[model samples]
Target chain A: MPDDAAGRPPVPGSDEAFRALADPTRRRILDLLADHGSLTVADLVAQFPGLVASGISKHLMALRAAGLVTAVRRGRHQVYAIDADGLGRALAPWAARYEAYWAEALTRLRAASTGTAGTDPRE
Target chain B: MPDDAAGRPPVPGSDEAFRALADPTRRRILDLLADHGSLTVADLVAQFPGLVASGISKHLMALRAAGLVTAVRRGRHQVYAIDADGLGRALAPWAARYEAYWAEALTRLRAASTGTAGTDPRE
Candidate 1:
């Protein structure tokens, strides 16, 4: 969402984001953050009964490294939240390459299918 | 897009999709297909000059395995296209969990930010 993003080279964080997304537990953590907006370590730890606080903390470290989550200290509490823009930005380059192409394809498909007797997607 | 997709268990190809997404070269190939819609093996061969068609074909095989690409035999030529829905559906389960959560967060943010002189996203 940067105002000067037009000419800027894509951030190198995409690879890290992809790597971060590989694990289910990490994905679950992101889901939790994105839903709740922000939470403390205690809040996050309570949700995962199967894993201890330290275990969740270790995964949070990886998430932070990947830029998928950000932690901020407010008084005595450290709050963690999903870096939503960071993630969407990280994947934007890859998604754009496909979506831009798909848009064009859809345009052509629409034009061709207009007068056709039978339109088949598999074709 | 299946009528029965609601009750159906998640497709097993998400892992394959994630694995396929890991490689830069394969991702590039998907970009080609996504942009152009459908291309024959020869059409795809022209795009990657450094790598021969066989090399590209190998990547395509992995893409096919990942359910990201589909091949249709048209006459003597084989046409390859990005299975857009397949890729989207494969990732939907993961994205949905986060987005559904994000929607709630946004609602809360909107309500709290309405009268505030300064809104802090990091908070």
Candidate 2:
């Protein structure tokens, strides 16, 4: 579960988001969407000419599962667009919470190390 | 690698860092080390009494490999402390680069969507 300050619900799509982010290929797909707006799977496949359509499609499925992108039928093609708001909603909370926690921990650690009543001996 | 802005050497230890952070238990261990100052493995073991010594040890080993924490000899005990500076150096660049990339993408996306020559038709 995300720490309390992340404020988002634990049971929602966060696990999938994390799983999607764990792969570099998925991140690259997000980058492409972010740069080029909506594009069909063919458009994305064009960007990676060496890779077959099936592999790119697999990455797209992972991104969709993570709520990072939205797909809509455009006549014969399925167009995919970055859901920037959704990505922000999913990621910022977790990152912000961790950043805050680390900041607080560092502050406390500094205080303890510097204070006259130093709690732990540094040896 | 690391999208350029995460300037640390790719070969040094990034893959390990990513792998280490992929686990929640390891993150929690880093959290505990952060909250408290340096602690011996025994001290950490005391906190998670339900789990056996070996499990926590495994988590610690992963964190150590990732450079998130440092262990030092203190008499007969091995003390572990959060390597805040190392973590900041490792994570900040990556996060900052992504944040900048996202900011740019959002700006471009907004302009394209709002302009008279709209780049993509929302269908």
Candidate 3:
């Protein structure tokens, strides 16, 4: 069963959005979508070797549920596209917070590595 | 069974690290650890309302497998702490790439929104 079945409401802040991104296959899908505007399921599946089409379809469903991608019917086939700025809007804030945290941590690490704790040479 | 059972080798670049972070509960756990140092499972469980202890234990295990936290046995109780600079080392690179991508996209969006597509008024 999907973890989203645990009655977690589909809020923008929900984990489902992030969880949908944790898979490498899905990340690759996003990269492909970013590079190429839209692709059919058959074309997307061809990007991954040794994986069955059914598995790719399931992964696509997860991405769709997370609002990361949209599937549209183009005649007899469905085409997938990265939802207009979907990840940029959803993940940017989350990543920005962590980026600030890590930036400070990295600066501290560099200072510690150089034995410059509490000493500002520019002073 | 865990999704990591797919025989994908545990490389730092593997999807497991990102997958481990896709959980909101785990993100909350990280936030708690950042605010307060080491905490035992019992202490951590108190932070969440209505969640069973065993479930929290499993969540911690998932975080541990992702190398996000370190658990040490203190007598009968096990205390977990955020691994020093773990996430900073792991997620910084990934998030940096995406940040650059979004920054450029945002710049473009702002330009497009302002109707400044190919005209350099500064000239």
Candidate 4:
């Protein structure tokens, strides 16, 4: 039922990636990983006092499933890190489509911020 | 309870935007709007024969709330178009954080495809 039947390859893992990113907690987790480079569930749980180990574990599972993160067994702890390559592979094509739009939007934003649209600098 | 209390301004509407993008049907709707520039509910419904107008309407509503689309009343129809500026504002910060990671990943990807990583050709 997907429109990809018209000869274009579907963006594999993109749906799972989007769904995984839908949670604020998960996005926060990515932020932590990006900041720390890698972390264990305990490390993450410590970062979010309001959340429990189980909850963080569940979020990590979703992130892993989405190919947004990778887990490696390190001694007694499982280390988790952002899977940058996997993330790019999963969402780049879809995200790239919006680059031109984003660029134009940013130009308009800068114009609004500086209050200097269509004004001659020499004037 | 959000982690933004420590002096960082939260990315507004990002949670809703991520949630809106989680659905394939909704993503397809964005693609349609991007391609066509604008469309009415009936126009969108006609694009997907299996989905009814109400279903597409709900998707549009979610997209609107996420600031991903804008609906305008023209004559007897409500027209929808991709709200590029809004979309940039909502997701740019969050997405920008991953730019470095994405760039490195792309470099690795190119190296992989061309099988020329660290191969000095001046030998």
Candidate 5:
């Protein structure tokens, strides 16, 4: 139910996001994009000696398809950057469930330490 | 460099976590476990009419391997529950990078919205 920066409906679900993040090489591409703000395919290829331009492009395509990164054509080069909101939309809800569980756990820990196990956690 | 509940070194990296989460059926199994607190293979199979106990067991094994879920032997059945800390350890660092980006983005947004784009974002 999330929307893109252009107000368009979201591209893919968490499954695609998870799939896109499954590869170490693809993750390295994301880290590069995060550090550089934006980079061209040539720039990315230069960073990984064993990787070719086509291989980098394919990874970028998967990232783009998952809405995890955005590519904009500036002149002859397509520069890519992390789509923070898109990534959040794909991951936040899933992460929140676990976070809530952790919060409750911490509350229980605090209560146990204080010898207030019978009292309300909020109190 | 996360430690498990037993204080052992983490079993897998974010790559395995992402791969394990990429499947819809596996995700559904996680959702069921989250809501129910814990479930056995037979219990999980009952939830999905088309899925067999073996299929659910396979999914549980993948989940366990990813450090996303924990299994405890209670009598003859293996009861599975969400391993929130293990899940967080596998995912937090990767998620934190994007979170930092989002935080900076919000700062920029606040600056732009207030017509004070020239000033330092932190200020």
Candidate 6:
């Protein structure tokens, strides 16, 4: 669980985080924010020619709820930026475990595919 | 794209993989298969107290589509097992990138949180 400004429980990094990340569009938004630091909704929407403003807003909301992005009031526009720290932390453990598993599996797969015995090409 | 048994294009490792993994029930199913090697549908369903057979079947379908598990006909019963190699490969790259990002962010965060300068405790 995350804490709010007042240290209260904040709904962040729940299954919603992965669900929000499941979308290609939202993933693109994060990529954009990562590359450009921050952008207004209009600016972010401009990057996707096929997406409507409302649709992008909905995506933004999902990202925000997942703590992947932070929306700030910049004058009249709500600017969004990648909350890199939060997003990175949220994904770390999941990635580390899977990476290790895959690395081992890939090694085994290579050895099996090559028909090599005893050598253990995976090592 | 993955290849079919006949070397045709098989749908595997698509967004469907992540979507299938989104369900906690399905994840638990994978975990069970990993632990038990293989089990019949009835056996797998018995592990879950409240879930219905149909629901578990649906989950099994999703997991199969995602290449997370494989089903084999053992007489009348359909036995399920974790497709460890496929599932492991599918999650590897995604996990690697996110883990690297998180590791860097954690380093920065620790420095900030401890109010230490120059030392770069993250290393």
**Residue-level error in angstroms, candidate 2, position B84:** 2.1
Ranking by TM-score: 4, 5, 6, 3, 2, 1
lDDT of 2 by residue, A1-123 (tens): 324332222325445666676665566676567657788999888776456799889989888878889999989999999876567555553464355434544455456646565323122
Q: Which pairs clash in model 3? A: none
Per-candidate interface DockQ score: 0.07, 0.06, 0.20, 0.28, 0.15, 0.18
Native A-B contacts reproduced, model 3: 0.31
Colliding pairs, model 6:
A95-B95
lDDT of 6 by residue, A12-120 (tens): 3535677887766676687678778899999987887676799889999999988889999989999999887778767653443334456666555555757553422
When summed lDDT is taken over every stretch of 10 residues in candidate 1 chain A, the lowest stretch is A1-10
lDDT of 4 by residue, A4-93 (tens): 332222554678998998888898899889878899999998877677799889999999999999999999999999998878776665
Identify the candidate with maximal DockQ. Answer: 4
Residue pairs with clashing backbones, model 5: none
TM per prediction: 0.57, 0.61, 0.66, 0.79, 0.71, 0.67
Top TM-score prediction, candidate number: 4
Runs of candidate 3 exceeding 4 Å displacement: A1-13, A73-76, A101-123, B1-13, B72-77, B100-123
How much is the lDDT of residue B117 in candidate 2?
A: 58
Q: Which candidate order results from sorting by lDDT in descending order?
A: 4, 5, 3, 6, 1, 2
Give residue B40's error in model 5 in angstroms. 0.7
Q: For each candidate, what is chain B's TM-score?
A: 0.66, 0.65, 0.68, 0.75, 0.70, 0.68
Candidate 4 local lDDT, B1-123, one digit each (tens): 544333323666677998998888788888889999999999888877777788789999999999999999999999999998888877766655675555555555456647565422111
Query: What CA root-mean-square deviation does each model show from the true structure?
Result: 12.9, 14.2, 10.6, 8.3, 12.3, 10.7
Interface RMSDs of all predictions? Answer: 12.6, 13.8, 10.3, 9.3, 12.5, 10.5
Q: What C-alpha lDDT, on a 0 to 100 scale, does residue B60 get in candidate 2?
A: 88
lDDT of 3 by residue, B16-60 (tens): 568887877777787678667799999988877657699889999
If both were scored by lDDT, which would come out higher, candidate 5 or candidate 6? 5
Q: Report the poorest 10 consecutive residues by lDDT, candidate 5 chain A.
A: A1-10
> Model 4 scores what on Cα lDDT?
0.77
How close to the true structure is residue B38 of candidate 3, measured as C-alpha lDDT?
90
